[model samples]
Target chain A: MKFLDFFRSKRPSSASIAKERLQIIVSHERRRPSTPDFLPSLQKDILEVVRKYIQINENQIKLSVDRNGDCEVLELNISLSDPGKK
Target chain B: MKFLDFFRSKRPSSASIAKERLQIIVSHERRRPSTPDFLPSLQKDILEVVRKYIQINENQIKLSVDRNGDCEVLELNISLSDPGKK
Candidate 1:
């Protein structure tokens, strides 16, 4: 039992932990997996939904998230399309 | 030696591999660990550097990244302060 417990209870080294944490941060900072292809799909959906009611300046839309410790804020910025165009 | 090699060579379970991948992607997707407090420091630096030449419309500035498969792009948007205000 003592031998089994010793094997089971050995802690991970600090360097490995730090490396793991760094990897997590880099992956998050880089925004993994989600493709840039998503933007056109989103733009199409948004325009389809909003075009009849109001013109949209598709160029100004922004979606982002900022993290501070455990707190996170998601930002959305959208500007109205030029009225003269309509 | 053959038995030792077999024990050493067993590939990690697929579920474990997937979970590790997901953890990496989530940590990356969430933009791990960078504090929002850093923004105030950045704003202060910008204001100090640019105050003599031009007022900055800090509200309009954006820094973001978009990724598509292996490709990644970083975006920076800055709008100058209203000239009339200065």
Candidate 2:
């Protein structure tokens, strides 16, 4: 009990919690695909196209989905680095 | 129209297409975070731990989520390199 006593945690709002979980899981899946060997090429292609709009942080792009009955919602977390004093 | 005629496409059912979209979106979201500067340390920590269980493909780790009413489901694509013919 003493080990736990030092930390006080508050439950997060359902939306925030869901968003957080979504970000983490999407990161994991993107890095590990069904076919592992082909990922490097895929990454290169993605990065090349992605660089046009934004300088990707290379570590924060996560993609995922939610199935609502028959409709599927795609969730993308587009985190951008500091615009660098622009 | 001729350019379009060269391509033949079949409409994917809501399920298969959803999965494909989910994978791509998750990949994007994981790479972009609310806070970009903190991602390197996160990746390093995750990789160091993940190396022991499996040689993570590194390029495919997409972390994401699905919010079901009040519950958040974490979806992780755990892809591994060939088990090395063990």
Candidate 3:
């Protein structure tokens, strides 16, 4: 009986459930805002800078802007393959 | 000669350098603004709710508020332990 109870307890915890709900809500909030007019130019400039030194596909770069209070944050994530391996 | 050049290429690429630079800049930007006044209370309330259902350490939960233009986003991340293991 104890073993059966243990197996049954495999149900997801409340914390996981809360996290899933929060992710959905946060992603929705992130997508609701229209991108700023300058974002495309910004991305293009950054991509050009990166391309000058490395051979990378377009998918390797990501750029996003997030706001905190009145402050704006530009976040860039780039994945680079080792040049030697290439 | 080619092998020697290959070993020398192990030096970090421009993309890696760019990423490191961006991380420093973004982290600085994230820290520049003072946290909002209501954030502590909000975290406490959420912690209380989560604690009601699971045994989790304080560090297991993370909460942050980020803004995008006029929109505000509350990001919550929680790590849950398997109840059966406990």
In terms of DockQ, which candidate is stronger, 1 or 2?
A: 2
In candidate 1, which residue ranges exceed 4 Å CA deviation? A1-52, A84-86, B1-86
Supply candidate 1's per-residue lDDT for B77. Answer: 33
Candidate 3 residue lDDT tens string, B1-86: 22122222332365432211111111101221332233334345544543443455656555565543222344454443232123
Model 3 regions more than 4 Å off: A1-39, A84-86, B1-86
lDDT tens digits, residue span A8-64, model 2 = 122235554333222232121222234233333343443444444345564656554
lDDT of 3 by residue, A1-86 (tens): 22122212332365532211110111101111332233334345544543443455656555565544322334454443232123
Interface RMSD of each: 20.9, 15.9, 22.0
The whole-model C-alpha lDDT of candidate 2 against the native structure comes to: 0.34
Q: DockQ: which is higher, 1 or 3?
A: 1
Query: Which is better, 1 or 3, measured by lDDT?
Result: 3
For residue B64, what is the lDDT in candidate 3? 60
* By DockQ: ranked, best first: 2, 1, 3
lDDT (Cα, tens digit) per residue for candidate 1, span A62-82? 445444322222333333223
Query: Which ten-residue region of model 1 chain B has the weakest summed lDDT?
Result: B20-29
